[model samples]
Target chain A: MRNSKMASHLSHFTHKTSFFTSNPRRPSPPCMSVVLSTAPTQSYWASIDAQIDAYLNKSIPIRSPESVFEPMHHLTFAAPRTTAASLCVAACEPAIHLMHAAAYTHEHLPLTDRPRPRPGIQHKYNPNIELLTGDGIIPFGLELLARSLDPARSNPDKILRVIVEITRATGSQGMVDGQYQELGLDQLGSEYDVIEYVCKKKEGELHACGAACGAILGGGAEEEIESLRRFGLYAGMVQGIQGKNKAGFMEEKIEKFKELALKELESLQGKKTELISSLVEPSLAAVQIS
Target chain B: MRNSKMASHLSHFTHKTSFFTSNPRRPSPPCMSVVLSTAPTQSYWASIDAQIDAYLNKSIPIRSPESVFEPMHHLTFAAPRTTAASLCVAACEPAIHLMHAAAYTHEHLPLTDRPRPRPGIQHKYNPNIELLTGDGIIPFGLELLARSLDPARSNPDKILRVIVEITRATGSQGMVDGQYQELGLDQLGSEYDVIEYVCKKKEGELHACGAACGAILGGGAEEEIESLRRFGLYAGMVQGIQGKNKAGFMEEKIEKFKELALKELESLQGKKTELISSLVEPSLAAVQIS
Candidate 1:
C-alpha cells in the first residue's frame, strides 16, 4: 500500500528530482517518478515522510527497552515536517528530522511547576519518560549519521565536518543557549535585538547546520555550502519571527529575510535551487495568507 | 601556585605513566615527572583535575549567554573524577570527562515532584537552567571529540568509531534506558536479574565505551580493545553494585566481578595494564575497608 502511494507520487515527478533518484545506492522501486519544481508542497512532503518512515524502520529496530524506543519512535514520526528537513539532500533528511524531533522533545519538556499540554507525543507519556527519551534521540541521530558514512562514496573528512557542524549548532552556544535565554526573556524584556538574537541562535542555527550538512554530504564546494548556510539562516529567521509578533516591523523584517534567503540561491543554477526556494515560499505564502 | 602544586605531584611519580607523558603532542611543564603505579590516587586525581580545569577553561570560553556557559562550566569542573576518565589516553581524557559530566548532569536532573538537593553544581542553579545545561553539555561533548580529530595524527575512521562507541553507550539502549528502567523499578520489582541488567546497561556500557575508545585512540589491536572493554564492563558492574546493597550476596557478586575484571587484563602486559588495574583497585579497597 505504501509502495503504491509512493509510486503514484513518483509518476507525477518524472522530470524532477525524487528522493530515490538523488540517492542511487538504494534501488528505486519499479515505478519511480522524479520531483519537479511545480510539485505541490503536500506531495513533496509525502515523499519525504515516506522516506523518513522507511529509514526509521530500518535504522531503529524496535526491540528490548520498549519503554524508551517506543516513545522515541513516536516522537520522530509525529514531529511536524519543516523546511529544515526539506532543504536537505535525501540521504540526510532522516537524520535532520531526528535532530528536529530531539530538539522539539527538549523544548517541550515540563520544566515549569505547572506543565502546559504539549501537542503530539508528550500527551502520551509522562514527563520523566519524555525527558529520558529526548536524551536518547540525540545520540541516536548522531549514530544514524555516523552509520551512513560510506568511505567508498563519501569523504570521511566531510562526514566529520558534518558531525561538527550539527554538534556546534546544537551545543551550548547555539540551540541550548537560545533556550536558556528564552527562559530569562521575562526578566530581560522582549526587545527586538534580544528576540532576534535568541531566534537566530535557537532556530536559525539549526537550519543553517542542516543546509550546511546537506551541502557537505552532497559534495558542494565551499562557496555553495556557505551560500546555503546563509540561505537556511535567513529562511529560519523568517520562520522564527513569524509567530513572535504581528506588528509592521516584524512583517518588514520577515520580507527582508525572505528576500535574503532567495538572493542566496540566485548565484546557483540547478534543480536544487528551485527545490530550496520552494521551502521558503510556503512560509511567505503562510504569512501573506494570514 | 597551581603550577607549584602540579610540580610537587610530578616529583612523586618519576617512573610511571603520566597524562602529559602519554601524549607527546602536549608540551610538559618545566618540572614534569612520570607517574608510577605507587603514586597515590589523590595525586592522580589532582593531576587529572588540573588537566580537566585547564581543558574546560580552554575549550569552553566564557562568552555571551553567560547564563548557559557558566553553569555548564560549573557542572563540568565540579563533577567527581571517575575511573572512566583515568582509563582514557591523555589526549582523550578531557572529552571523556565532558561525557561524564554531561551524563552526571542528566542523572541528577530534578525529575521527581519533590526535588532533592543535589551535591554539586545543582545547588547553584535553578531546575530550568540545570535542565537546559544538561541539554547543552551533550552536544558540547560531541563537538569536543570531533574537534579533537586530526587526520594527521588520528584516523577519521577510528575517531568515528569512538564517537559511535560513546553515543551507543550513552544512548537509549544504554544509559538513558537504564535511567528509564530505574524509574519503573518500583513497578517491576528489583530482582537481581533486573538490577544487574540496569547496571550493566547504564554503568557497565559507559565504562566499556571509555576503555574501548581509549584503546582505539591509543592504537590498540582488536584483541586488546576487546579485553579492555570486558575489563571496563566487569569493573563498572562492581562500581554500580557497590552502593546498592551490603548483603552477603552483593559482596559475593562484587568479588566475582572484580576477579573477572582482573582476569581480562591478565593477557595484556605493559604499563597500561598496571594503570588500568589501578582504576579498579580503589573501589575494591573501599569495599574491603568498609
Candidate 2:
C-alpha cells in the first residue's frame, strides 16, 4: 500500500498505541498475517517476521540455563524484527547478522541490571553468531552461540565477512558514530552543511551498512555492493531529515538523496535491484510531506 | 627477562611510582627504551609502545575541531599496547583493526559529555579505518577513517576478515561476554570448573582472536590458525587465573594452558612460530609464582 494510505490508517491510533503492538492481551495466532492489514507492504512485513522466526527456530535451539537463553529468546523471538533485519532478508542476506544487529542495538539501550548467575554446563555446540547484550544474561548468550559454532561445518570466510560488515556498520564508524554526531549537533547547534554531514554519518551510515551487508552476503560483486551501500546511505539521509521534520531546503535535500538512491539502484543487474527497490518503497513513499 | 626479575623491579616501586608511567615529568629520549628497564622483555615492550605510537601517528592525523581526534589521539598514544594488537601485528595483520580495538575499549569507559558540533568539511582523505569514539570526539574519528580508506587501494576481502575477527573478539562471544560472565560469577559465587570456563572466555577469547587474526593475516593454514587461537586461549586462561591470584588448582590449570600453548607453537613452521612465542613470552612469564 502507498505510504500515505498506511500513514492515514496509522494516524487513527492514539499516541500511546505503538505502530507495532506489544500487548499480550491481543491473541497471537499461528500466523502474524491475521494481525496485519491486507496491504502488500504489511504482508511483506508478516512474511519477514515468519522468516525471522523460522531462522531462529532452526538456528537457536532452546538451551539450558534460563539466565542466558531466556533473555536472548526474549530479544530474538519475542521482540519484533528490526526494519534493518527485514531489509537485509528482503535483499537475501543470511539472517545471522541480523541477530548481531539486534544485539548491537540492545547494547546501546540505557537499561542495566541484567540477570546474573555463573554459566551452567559446558555448552558443546557454538553458533558462529555470538550475542553479547551487556546488561547480563545476554552476555552469556554470546558464549552459547560461540560454543554452538562447529568450525568444521561453518565457512570461516563467510563468518569473517559478516563480522566485518556488521562491526563497521555498528561501531564508531557507523551507527554509534552517527549517534555521537547527532548528540553533538543537538548540544552545540550547527549550520545546515554541518548538520547534513553529521546526519549522514549518524543515520545514513547504518542503513548503508545494512544494505551493503545484504549485498555482500548475497555475493554481489564490488560494484553491486557499492551501489546498494549508496542506496542505503541516501535512503537513510532522506529518512533522517524527514523523521526530524527539519525545515529549510529539507525538501530539496530529500529529493537529492532520493535521486541518488534511484541512480544506484538503476546501476544494478537482475531481480535483486528490483527486490531492493520494492523493499525501499515504504521509505521512499515516506516523502509525500503530508 | 625472567618474570621474577621483572617482578622484583616492579616491587621496588612505591604505589606513587606507577608501573607504566604516563607522566611527562620523567626525562625522555627519542626511544621508549629510556623509560623501560634494561631487561630484554622491557625492550620488547618498548618496541611495542613505539609500534603503537607509529601506527597512531600514521593513521590518525592531527585534524581540526580537536574534539574527536584529541581523545582518540590520547587513547591510542598514551596507553600501553594490548597483547591483542601486538599479536595481530606480529601475525602480519593490517594495523587498521588495531584502531578499532582502541575505539571499542574506549567506548566502555564511564566518561561521557562530549563536544557538540557538526563535523567540519568533507574530511578530504577519509581513512578506511573510521574512528567512532562516541562519548564525544570518537564517533567523528570513525568517519574520518572510513573516508580515508580509498576503495581502489584496499582489499575488501582482507578488510572484511579483520573486521569479523576483531568484532567477535570484543563482542558477546569474546571479551564482553566473558566480562558479563565474570560479573555473574562474582555475584552468584562460582566453582572452579565454572571459573575456568568463564576465565577462558573472559581473558582467553580475545587473546585467541588476536592470535588467530595474526595467523589469518599472516596467511597461515586453517590448522595453523586454529592452533594459534587455541594457544592464545589457553595462555589467556593461565593469565586470567594468575592475575586473580587464585590458589590450589591454579598452578595445574596454568601448566595445562602453558603446555597447550607450547604444543601449538611446536606444531607451527619456522620463524612465524618463533615470533608468536616471543610475543607471548611476557604474558606467560607473568605466571611466575614469585
Highest lDDT: which candidate? 1
Give one digit per residue, the lDDT tens place, for model 1 in B1-290: 13233233333332334323456554332111222335455565566567556656767777656777788888877677766665664444566677777777766776543356555534567667777787778877776666664333446777677788878888887888878777662345556766777778876887888777767766667997898899889888888877566435678878888899999988776534544565567643222110
- C-alpha RMSD in Å of predicted model 1 compared with the true structure: 7.1
TM-score of 2: 0.58
Best by TM-score: 1
lDDT of each candidate versus the true structure = 0.66, 0.46
The docking category that best describes candidate 2 is: incorrect
Pairs with backbone N, CA or C atoms under 3 Å apart (clashes), candidate 1 = A10-A33, A13-A34, A16-A35, B13-B34, B16-B35
Give the Å shift of residue A12 in candidate 2. 37
lDDT of 2 at A266: 82
Q: What are the TM-scores, per candidate, against the unseen true structure?
A: 0.82, 0.58
Q: After superposition, how far is residue A11 of candidate 2 from its true place, in Å?
A: 39
**Which regions in candidate 1 have their CA more than 4 angstroms from the true location?**
A1-42, A112-122, A185-189, A245-249, A269-272, A283-290, B1-42, B112-122, B185-191, B245-249, B270-272, B282-290
Residue A147 miss distance in model 2 (angstroms): 15
